[model samples]
Target chain A: MDFTYDDEQEALRDAVRGLVGKAYHDYEQRRQAVKEDPGFSEQQWARLAEMGVLGLPFAEEDGGVGAGPTEIGIVCQELGRTIAPEPFLASVVLAGGLVSAAGTPEQRAEVLGALAAGERLLAFAHDEPGRRWGASAEQVTASADGDSWSLTGVKEPVPHGARADLLVVSAALPEGGTGLFLVQPDADGVTREGYATYDGGRAAKVAFDGAAATPLGEAGLDVTASIATVQDITRVMAGNQALGAMQTLLKATTDYLKTRKQFGVTLNTFQALNFRAADMYTSLELTHSLVAWATMVIAAGDPDEVAEAAARASLQVSRGGRHVGQEAIQLHGGIAMTAEYSVGMFVAHLTALDHLLGDGNHQVRVLSTKVADYDALDPLDV
Target chain B: MIEGRELTKEQIVEAQQTLNAAGLAVPHWPEEYGGRGWTDLQRHIWLEELQRAGVPTPLAFNASMIGPVIAHFGTEEQKKEFLPKTANLDIWWSQGFSEPDAGSDLASLRTTAVKDGDDWVVNGQKAWTTLGQFGDWIFTLVRTDPDVKKQAGISMLLIDMTSPGLEVRPVQLIDGSYEVNEVWFDDVRVPADNLVGELNGGWTIAKFLLGNERVGVAPVGSTKRILARAKDLAKETSDGEGGTLLDDPLVRARIVELENELLALELTALRVVAHSADGEPHPASSVLKLKGTELQQAVSELMVDLAGPASVASGAGDASDLAEWARISTPTYLNLRKASIYGGSNEIQRQIISRTILGL
Candidate 1:
């Protein structure tokens, strides 16, 4: 029932907000200078790592700041304010999450420490040429030669693949099961062809032709469960980013409304249009609460709760976040349509986040089946 | 109004038993005075389950508009007679909010009921009275003082639907649904003791009802259900003369865009619900209403677009038994046209935001 963030979480928000304000006040310039660039600047990434921001969510046993989910939520929120080109989720969340979930002691040391130090960038190599997300995997083959495993198959839409030093690959086992393997980008028979995605992120189509790889943990580790953990992080972190993006979009549009004079009056003075802006602000806040709650549940290590929370979070971020982005862009008029404006950065990222894995539509389908029938029982139970 | 979603017989019995168990059966009633002590979220859980299962909110005319007004303003003796039965749906209630002459200009309602010995003889016609066909009783607003300006001197009265000279005729809307009604009260007799609240104060109560009604109308869960149908349907059929509808960039883009919009609104709804202080509604609730309704319509349009010609009819020649979808879309789309107009039109909402929320 308690909804307020603790003091540390508030401080985390203030700190990240300050950093984002200074570094990303104007994202359009950042996007242009870094367009199709390999990755986030090492200096900036190292600075964030040094600050312990990159390890906000990992336990203390690993090389993380040991901050709770709320703290990580704050970092994601600030990163979202700017169209942060850093693969925060792809590396820290997705890859780090897999290692944390299924990695042996040695695997955790090799991958997580570098990630916590921000010395290496990693990408998740799941979602092959399969028809939909979280279904059957068509790519990333795993065949065993003795106890050693070799992988072959292409992983498309690999976020940050071009810059990744480590790639967490989901491999299909010969025994009619699937598991994850830690593959090096420079491994033999592995080729990363780069492309720039619409959301201003560098992605790659990675073809692994019998590439040498090492299993992070036991062969046939639960990929779905591991990915669920990653998805829990992804949903909450994505929600955080969406919250920040919507806030920026709303603020920018609010400024536009105050200044953009038409029919001899500021747009704010017009009830006919100002209502939509007010609505955008309201929706932004609503989505924020849902994401905030999800962060808490994930941090608390409640997977069932996380599942419900993820569904709800995805529901809001993909649904409400999209509305605020659209209205904010539309309210900004022609300026928002052009790439030169920062609002476009927010719009593209919001849309990209909306479609990644699935949009609200897909989330609804996923969320509903989990509970085929709701027995209208006591609300306290939920 | 009975929103076309039907209830199962067992559910109807459950509803009756649940209501009968409560000392005060009014779903909208505040927690005190024998009502269910539920928060807005809990109440919403009830409504969500019902709608997601295609069960309408327990009798809206009673729970939403009338019963709350009576509970708030009724005399003790009036409560004794009306509140209990209204809660139990023992007496089906209908609202007399809009007349043909004052659909949107609700404050300008011309219905009149003059004072009489121990009784008020009402003579007026009300239109778009949802579910007037089943109304055993009605709560109406009458212009008691013509000398006063519009929105002033209106009195709230409780009248038995079967009173002398009262008539209810169903109005079939363009959706081919019999939800609304045209009710004529030709000098009908309503006991003076039946007036729930003070004269000239009905406008205040009516406004409060509008506020309470805002919480559930966004229908986020139901819209989720609709979007689910579209996604399922698109996966089966092609986007007309194409490889597949989902492969059709144009349709896919629209669905994705609408899905995103719907997600944003659902978050907005949760945020608004979370931000609500006490049980009282906020000006921001109006914001949820506006966006939520818009997204509902947009999702409906996508359902139709995804279904294409299949969406137009109730059935398909192939295994395309998208009957639930085909049956729902056109009506749902037509029903959503009022999104901009109801609970104080979106234009009015903007005014509230500009003047009330922003102090501009």
Candidate 2:
């Protein structure tokens, strides 16, 4: 029932804020980091690992700090505030989460251990060329030969795929249902073509031509449900990240309104623009509330409920992100249109996050199907 | 027994007495002042349960607005004289804050109360006095010192509606209802003892009262009730294709989006309530008013849209064989436009967010 973070959570927030904020406080630092290949700072990722953030969501035995969703959400939000291009969500939450969710004890130990130590980077290659944010893989199919497995298909726009040392790939199985497999980027018959995304991040079109693969957990078993659940969890985490970026956009926009002058006075003098900024603040606050609530739903640990909560949160974040993002740039006038300023970058990241899991319309379609199933939605009841 | 209509004064009084007997009338006040000493969450639950049970709430001028002000700033005599009666609706109160020129800028109100011996002669007009016909007394803000700043010269006074030289004239609205009125005072005399707080301190009291007004104005539970009922109504209304309106994809999508937004608003209300402790209001309270009113208006608009052609027959009597809900839909929607307009218009709420919250 309490929304205020406890002292320890507050400390985690301050620690993350200090690290990420220090690295990305100046916009040029993020610009410079994203200007080259890999799209983020390797040293910054190692520092986050040293700070134990990479291990926040895993069990101690599995080489994680075993922190709750709220703590993990804190890290996401702090990273989002700076729009830090660290691939934390892509590597730690998405890829590492898939392994933690469907991986065997041995896999969890080997993968998460290396991940937490910053010794390796992993990316979730679930998104294929034709598939649109679905949990199951259609184009990619896995084949088994005695005690070995190989994957053949193409997964386009795999976030950080080229940079990742390991790839957690979802593929259609011969027996039935979707199964998860692990593949190395440099495995034989695997090719990765890296490119820059609009949001100052890296993605790759990975072609797997009979690439060697190992089953993430049980062989030939359907991990579709597990994949969906992990995606749901990642969706909630993405919401937290969006909240962080929106907060910064609002702060930066408001600051610009106060300082940036036009004609005879500062921008804040115009009621029309201030009113628009006010709407942005409202959007941010509403998104923030839902994000916090959805994170707690994840902390509650019910898979179906987590999925629904994630959709609800994603819907809000999608809508709010657009309202805040577009208005942020529009209110700031020409400066926001350029790469030298931070507001436009925030909008780009928001646009990216909006579609990363599911956009507002997509989430709405998901929710609309079950609209009549409940008499009313009561968040506290659960 | 009735669900969703204005209650007669007797019904309201009886309901108030029933709630007061159970100590549920004013749970947010101090226990010494007839409160239940409930937490904010409990108070929220109380309101939600009341709405779900189809019970008309206790008079807001008493339970929410004036009751708290009296408890916080009233003399012991004022508390003793007002709290018990206010809780039981023995004294139905009406608000007299808005004037023709002072709707949003209320401090600029020209209502004058001149000191004349032990009585204050009041002269001015108040606009948009809601439910004043049922009010036994009116709480007013009057200018006592014209020489000082407009806000600094004001005072709050409790005036007996039966006083001499007072008039109440109903103002017809777009909905063709007389729910609000204009009350004029022609040198109406009031005993100086009726002043609620310090002279020239009414501005602070007005702000406090308005803050309370904004917090409760969300009507989340009531909106949820209406939305749920809308779903049922959608199921009953035919869509010309031999199927119910709810069968349409667009209809269902609209309902789902509204439901989700309402859910978000309700959760935001809960978050605001949970954080508003130790007497400091949460900054998000402004969002509650802004989005709360928007959602309220949205649901009402949806109801009208659902009504479609039947909405034009809003004035149809029961004999028309038209569904009562469809008949009332348009008026309800028109009436709800005031929800955003009153309670410190949504635009004012945005101003609060920008200046107070965003420091813009």
Best by lDDT: 2
Give the TM-score of each candidate: 0.72, 0.98
| Residue range B79-180, candidate 2, lDDT tens digits | 989889998898999999999999989989999999999999999999999999888899999998999989999999999999999899999999888899
Q: After aligning candidate 1 to the native by TM-score, how far in Å is the CA of B174 from where it should be? A: 4.9
DockQ result, candidate 1: 0.14
Poorest stretch of ten by lDDT in candidate 2 chain A: A373-382
lDDT of 2 by residue, A304-350 (tens): 89999999999999999999999999998898999999999999999
Instruction: Provide backbone clash counts, one per model.
Output: 11, 0
Docking class of 1: incorrect
lDDT of 1 at A205: 92
Off by over 4 Å in 2: B1-3
- Candidate 1, chain A: TM-score against the reference: 0.95
Cα lDDT of model 1 overall? Answer: 0.73
TM-score of 2: 0.98
